[model samples]
Target: MIPDPDEQVLVDVRAPLREMIFPFLETIVITGVLWIVIGWFDAADAGRYGVGPLRLPPEWRNGFVYLWVMLVLWRFVLPLLRKRRRRMVVTDRRIIFRADGFRARPRTLAMSAVTWAEKERGLLAVYLQDSDLPVYYSGLPKIRKIARMINDPLI
Candidate 1:
């Protein structure tokens, strides 16, 4: 994303792809199970011996197809698109988050409004003096250092 006029960007990053591993694995497991069941049912026609293509009842097949579509779309495709399109930008004057699928406008937090920024687990938590809750910035490497940088302009 282009920085605002008179603004300098310090960090521009998207969430890493590794974050999608679990969902990909889940799709694999679910598909594998469905294939195995269908294959077993297809083997030996009428419980007799013969090699043939796997087939499910029409209703069952349709349902499974819909399930697979939803799984692929929701777990795999959507996240991939989101990861590619979204960005977290820390600028000299403000911190901004943009996700194409999530919002039309980038969420902006002025650095001037931040009272403190701290590292919690692997995320950067920015605390505003007006709000008790901290907004977290995830998927950033060297989160502790980044927190310090955000908290202190001098650094």
Candidate 2:
């Protein structure tokens, strides 16, 4: 929905970095393993460790490693690219979360629905009256200031 004319945006920024941690870690681990395996094979191509007789063609092996690295790294790269398209906007009336450009409808949580806000496990957990569970957000550069805004009644 289009925002109400009276609603004023308080904060407009990217989504939390919490969502990115796992994808990057997984990509790094897989790519590192691939590099190690390729290095082992390349050692033979370099005529090292008496495995010179087992050396395969260097060109194909290099190409294979490059392709594999790109494939594995894409997992992390795609998310990083898409994350730039998403944003979190905090307004006086509500909080609007735009997940990506392709999503026509954004998710929003009304400020009036919020019962309280607290920090938990490096995240800001906002408790809502309509739900039993709290919605969490992180990655704000000024954590304390945002927490204060969330908890402030006059905000």
Candidate 3:
């Protein structure tokens, strides 16, 4: 978590969210590479091999090409085009989330809206995210204060 300009806390939701990124990229990259390589092999073995019949005709290259294009585009290009605009700010009264990349809304969640929060130090939970949900902090240096604040009686 990083401190905001007015000293309000910023708890990045990215850490847990980050767990999904690499695996997703790896899947896409591996699948894309494998498919493209298979397509290339099939194209090369057009007459002599038995696999050519299993592949789409060369005329369908456009479709496979388009699929790979979209995969690569979504995997790499889209994010660059979509501005990275996610901010999770925790203030005295509320938690504000602003995301402008895929979605175009700046949402704000009031502290009172936080129905529940708990900490889990179990091994599974620790490696999965090092935190629990409905979590309010994300490595935001002052975890104790935030936990105490959220669990505070005043609300």
Top TM-score model: 1
TM-score of predicted model 2?
0.58
Local accuracy of candidate 2 as per-residue lDDT tens digits, 87-127? 66667888776665455367899899988877777776889
| Clashing residue pairs in candidate 1 (N, C-alpha, C atoms within 3 angstroms) | none
| Candidate whose lDDT is highest | 1
Q: List the residue pairs that clash in candidate 3.
A: 1-139, 1-140
lDDT of each: 0.74, 0.73, 0.51
Off by over 4 Å in 2: 1-7, 16-33, 36-49, 57-63, 82-86, 98-105, 129-143, 153-155
lDDT of 3: 0.51
Task: Give the number of colliding residue pairs in candidate 3.
Answer: 2
Off by over 4 Å in 3: 1-4, 18-46, 50-58, 72-87, 98-101, 109-149, 152-155
C-alpha positional error of residue 19 in candidate 3 after TM-score superposition, expressed in Å:
5.3
**Model 3 — TM-score against the truth?**
0.43
Which regions in candidate 1 have their CA more than 4 angstroms from the true location? 37-67, 83-86, 99-101, 129-133, 138-141, 152-155
Backbone Cα, N, C clashes tallied per candidate? 0, 0, 2
